[model samples]
Target: MTKGGDEQLVGSSSADTAASSTSDVGLVDETKSKGNTTNSTTDPEVDQPEVKKGEVPRGPGPFFYIGGANGAGLVSVYCRSKGWQRIHDNKREDYKLKWCETKSRETYYNFKEGEQLLYQIPNNKVLTTKIGLLSSLREYERVMNKISTNLNPKHVEIPDPKVAAVMNPLVWVKASEKFSQRILKMEDFFPESFRLDIKDEKEAFFELYKDTQIWICKPTCSNQGRGIFLLKNQAAVKSLQARLQSIEEDPVYKKLPYKAPQARVVQRYIQKPLLLEGKKFDVRSYFLIACTVPYVLFFGHGYVRLTCTRYDATSDDLTAHLTNQYMQKKNPLYSQLKEETVWRMERFNSYVNDKFRQAKGLPKDWVFTVFTKRMQQIMMQCFLAVKSKLECKRGYFDLIGCDFLVDENFKVWLLEMNANPALHTNCAVLQDVIPTVVNETLDLVLEIFNKSLKGQRIVPLQTLCHFVLLHNGGA
Candidate 1:
């Protein structure tokens, strides 16, 4: 097992064994003949599909798993564990790639390497690769259509970015400025100063909250606590500004840098954060939705990420200020902490379970049951709002990570909704949960396919039954 935080490599051969089984069966070719000069289809055996000028060819089946390159590996591992054939191969060098069919030993679909394959299994499943975009509306529509067709439903549609902005703008938080604005809007949730739009009038922010002890600055869209700062005084901000300016002048920093500079946000520092043994941390809750049924499910597992140092609202205490994995690893505290006392998801779950159990009025499995139900309600509301606004159908969001900040009051604040949540199964907690999660996700896809087929078959069966009854009665 590899030891990196997110990139931990757990040697699980179940996926490999499953993949081998599917490959041994051989590939089944299901290409339809198009007898025309213009509608030329590539022969899988001889010539690879021409890297065409237009649209890439759709795969023979519906069942795609699109995620980050790291996520792709995890999904592949999970799919192989279940003995399901993965049609798309990222390692293939040929521009034109194909879905391997184990039964017939042939490729079913052909498209360019790194090109997103729109897959649809006739009456069975469909999946597509996730493509990166440079903020193009046409490209967004194309991806939406591909997802809709792959799912085979009109109501299950891709989420519109515009609609998503209204429901959960965290997806667009690509800079610190946006993050600051978002935090300021949450003043009702946080009593601290959450000022925004003060780039030109930075004094307005300071004037309103001059008495505050500490403030944290963050870049809007970055994750894992990058480009975050803790400032105690005007001199601290000035000093940090000088450092940033120095970094800007560095040759290496100048060569590779962020495209935009005005994406930072600042927040009033939390003074008395609830802590375990003086360390600061936060929780990430995993949520899932099945588009067909419009249902939400939460994994009964998540880990607590603890900063390695005791709570501090000072600029010098980097570990105390940032509760992120990257920062935690660097802090000497992580090394000093007892191995049994280290933060882990399963331990957190156990703690929640025990706490709830000990409470007089709380229901058993209250955290799992009640929290999941509320999460579902919130998601349903969000989905309905998006659907009404966007007029889309047949799109499923299989997984999402909802970050939460717990106050002294024990209230949970929805920090953000991660649309494309990372799915690495390397962690011990994730390793156990991931296989089940993948199975459930795939099962939902299969269910939708079966339901569509059943609906189509129902009409003909009912018609035949009515005709047979009439004929027998007349006889």
Candidate 2:
């Protein structure tokens, strides 16, 4: 074992130093007899020094805890709690190193003595894993490639609709639509009343008329209540088309803030929405899958997000259509709007449990029995569809946020699925949901690592050390 001149072995036995050369450091079989002190017996011809029993031996490879800054820190806490040793820290910089090797390898030098850090792990190669915005459809492929390449240290990416569509081409819903349909089968899912007119001479409207009074105009790729307009009159349809065309033509619209150039799908609108205190709202039930196995374990608890304003199809009030935190804060209808009032998944579940229990004639298990059961089925379908298409398994997704609407009939219609579900604990519901989210995330990561390691030998120390430094702080 080569050590820097200034390096000192702390908390290590004398045997550790002598056995370091054996390449299995700090791992001794306790069942071995205590009388056998040295690794090597006296051989007069060779004149080799005897390996002492109390010495530390070098391990096969380095151990790392890799993730984003917050994730890395969380794992660090977890590892420390478990009393696991041989840990190193790094960040995305290490991953960049894997991609870009020609760039000069950085050398750390002490200004006064011209020496590197004494205790720095040496000859350890890095395995870098980056976690960031899966910004576009193209980035999805890039992220998946990185994940596949580094199989040891897993990557966690949060993908939006476009990326999710690229990974698994599924139908999405506009916020305005009461019922968002998942493409169970390309043929059967399309309504019998609807027809696809690819080359219709009249580009006046792509119409889905359930009845004369109700119509929904949905742009295929828009999200967060954007690019949707109800057609009350013929003029409204024309006006919407003109507006959409103008948006498509704008340079800025071609980039961020707009997902134009993508075709928009229009459907029939649901005029009647069940009101809570005369306010129209939707619940954002966050679903998570540890692994995309045939049988999946879902983290049930999620939050309900309420729109501050009452339902009005004609009104372009931000709060009316969007259940987003950003839009909700701006809406004046919510009497007590504070950052902390935001709820998490668990809190929302508890609230629902209590609220339904207190209601005059509601069933005893209204939320768990009816609401959550329906939500689970919808999510299971979505996950099954996604898993059937994608190759990789063992991912943590904020699966479908099933936004539902209860009509006068009290029938629930599935709304849009939010692939990249936001976990904000500003509300009590969100705050309570964080623990389950964290635990489920960790569980998935461990399961992936364990599965990958099953038929494989311990990774080389150099590689492991590199991953640790890169993942922890060396990035």
Candidate 3:
């Protein structure tokens, strides 16, 4: 398949259009009713009744609404396969499922909790934005540390000797492990980060800064490697600090939100990243919050995004440093070398096996085993970090795109999480991957939603395809 143009993220301003592949299906326009139905009390096609009290009656139905064109093709195909009719109007609240690219306040305000399947959980920025993630992680760390201190052996109860004889003596150890399992050590997977907007955090970064160190500065709310640059010298860091300080002091800038720069975070750059065939790359994986009621989560494999040119630490071009598809597309050789820019997980696993298996003392299938588990653990840690803070409802679900970096030492580091990941079938690998991810996402969502509506248990999900179960908060 020839690589077409890339698609926009969830909150992007791109115009929404019906999937060209689904041209045969009728996607009823919201602005104009199908002829003669404008004055009718109910639409005969969907059989939806007139609104009462701003809510539709609760029940499973065969109507879906896709708010954008990014992944609309696969979503439409999936809905069509299930004989579900598509709802074209974004304002229509009667749809059984609404997959909106951008999260809107109106959607949540009008949400019929248990009756509708909404795509994103409200207030998910707690884990998605750079500053939000950093804050949540720090706050979570503080809470967990306090709890762990209380759970120390010194505070443990002294068991009866006679009763302890038959029971496992490692009760406290098990308890501690159980608590720790929910959140991994941030240092183990996440790079050190500091928020530039906060004064103390900014000073702390400068205090810890070294002449030889490198830091990658990024915008808090942006994606696709936009406004990301490396700080290799003290001058670069100071310039950034001065610029931000000026902005903070500018009353006019503060009042004009549209002109103000977004908040930012500077992360210690992974200087020794492992390269594939001399090109820098990063793994793009899925962290799906499939169900929020009791929280059913999954981890799905995503293809690797590799830089077009050979990686060079001294290179000033961002295309050499940033491995995102958007960054790579800027290179002149992108169209010719496009095929080498993306690799399926299996290809990555095989390459690692052949190249670094013996040399690095890695396992035969290290990519699928150790590396995968590391990613899962990191993702779980991030989820648990903001689990309590996230706004949850029965109908809400989320699919976050998680970026990971593998160092030369085989250490996995979580870079950042994106709310609305791109689902463009731009290349051969995306064509093979994106559709499956969306389909399985819908499959599991429908299964859980339908089962929950019928008072059925949420476990033993029969529709879980390639997605691996991370956490099942039960029915």
Candidate 4:
């Protein structure tokens, strides 16, 4: 998995294929086809897409997982599983690249003047602490997107997350109710989306995309699919709001809100997600921004999690609508769901082609190509949102696990952005991929931090992971 022996961290989320792992089934490539292309007609397999190269200063040191609560421990296990050593005693670590939040000490600490803790620690402890969690990306996306326009002359906007989030049923509905009267003009090439609310989102089902019936509502900042639910109409929607209000007002029900106590991100359900046998499934793509300063991104092959039960939006089954591993494990079908529930993109690709080769209404060939493009666009947008503002004072990088779903039309929809996606391997499938991914990401982080260090091996490195440079940290 090492990038040759050079270990040079060249800036890239858009990489020139240093290496690729093909044996792992279900793991798909995250490369973007460069030519003028649209969702409807792009050849995802366009060989030798335009690749660019640029050099950035790199730093050295071993990397480890931080934020132990949100899959950090799992990452640590994976790293150790791969023969990487863990820093048992924090005192001896030096020039060592460690990622920590406010809760850390000399390693990563609370920011206080005397103790050098709390708020101040994140300045160096973590990359840059956000008043908002990754889950709150909804409100802060503009801050991230603002980076591209402000820093780059090309003004190459990463449009997926920008489009996906803004077009969310909750966002547009609230906007139209508050700002519909005023018109916001657009450029010719910008993506198109309908400005609709919860009511409209639901009505779109019976009146527009008749195949869709229920709407999915989620708390803006949550994990393990805890606050997610399905809405049938105004009554259900009202009940949800009432429940939130009750939690907010009740003493036992509330502690503190991650973002807004009652806030939620809602969208119409994709009534027709492709089912694996009897179960409904969704894909999880991991996008690694090895270094934000130089704006390096990696769209690696990812794992997929599926529901335990057969697909049934009408059944009011939460497991069916939500396919995250955390949510799926709770169902009675969990035992049988193990091998069937999770998959690698490599296996997924094989299955899709073998099973759905001639299946009608499936945009089968373009799934990987389209899915990859969407993931890249979203990833770029995320970095753009925070690139300029991200205080990478000492090599602070983030690996985001983004979720997506493909409607029966094969039009992929960016579902939710998890600030802290879990890293638990409840099944055998994840053991093969997740740890390797963590190892690869750690390598990239080290490369970016030590790219300019003396006596480092620098070569045209080759590995399965492709590095894509979105914005230069030095720029």
C-alpha TM-scores of all predictions: 0.50, 0.49, 0.83, 0.59
Off by over 4 Å in 4: 1-95, 99-213, 244-262, 355-365, 453-459, 462-475
Clashes of 3: 0
Local distance difference test scores for all models: 0.38, 0.36, 0.76, 0.47
Please estimate how well model 2 matches the true structure, expressed as its whole-model Cα lDDT: 0.36
After TM-score superposition, the amount by which residue 29's alpha carbon in candidate 4 deviates from its true location, in angstroms, is 35
| Highest lDDT scorer | 3
Least lDDT summed over 10 consecutive residues: which range in candidate 4? Answer: 1-10
The TM-score between candidate 3 and the true structure equals 0.83
In model 1, the runs with Cα more than 4 Å from the true position are: 1-67, 81-84, 87-204, 237-258, 292-301, 333-346, 349-398, 425-427, 445-475
- The superposed Cα distance between candidate 1 and the true structure at residue 457, in angstroms, equals 15
Question: Residue-wise lDDT of candidate 2 within 1-475, one digit each (tens)?
Answer: 1222112111110010111122222223211111111222121112123222344323432233222121222333443344433222222122110110001113111111111011111111010000000011123335444544443222324357676556421222232122323223221212111111222411434342322454555433334454455567766666755776687578886676423343444544556765554556556554443223222334345555667665686675656765666556667755475432344435544654565446535555565666666656654444433332332222211222335555433445555444323433344454455445544554443443344335332222221210111111101
Pitting candidate 2 against candidate 4, the one with the higher lDDT is: 4
List clash counts for every candidate, in order.
Answer: 43, 37, 0, 55
Q: For model 3, how does the per-residue alpha-carbon lDDT over 1-475 read when each residue is reduced to its tens digit?
A: 1111112111222111122223213433211111111111221122233323335434455778766555755676777677677756567788888876655557767889888898866567677778777777887889998887666666656568776566553776778778877666789888999988778999999888887998999877766676799999899888987898799889998798457776778999998899999989999999998888778899999999999989888788999999877777789998899878999999999999999999999988999999999889889888888787777788788888889999999889998887767776667787789888988998898788778778788889898879999988883
Query: For candidate 1, lDDT tens digit of each residue in 192-293?
Result: 433222344344555554434677775433444555667777777666557655665777656765432423445666566656556666665554443222
Candidate 3, residue 300: how far the Cα is off, in Å: 0.7
Tens digits of lDDT, candidate 4, 190-301: 1222222234533443344322346666543344566667777667756765665565677654554322253444555677877777677878877666653344557765
Question: Which 10-residue window in model 1 sums to the lowest lDDT?
Answer: 125-134
Q: lDDT score, residue 333, model 3?
A: 98
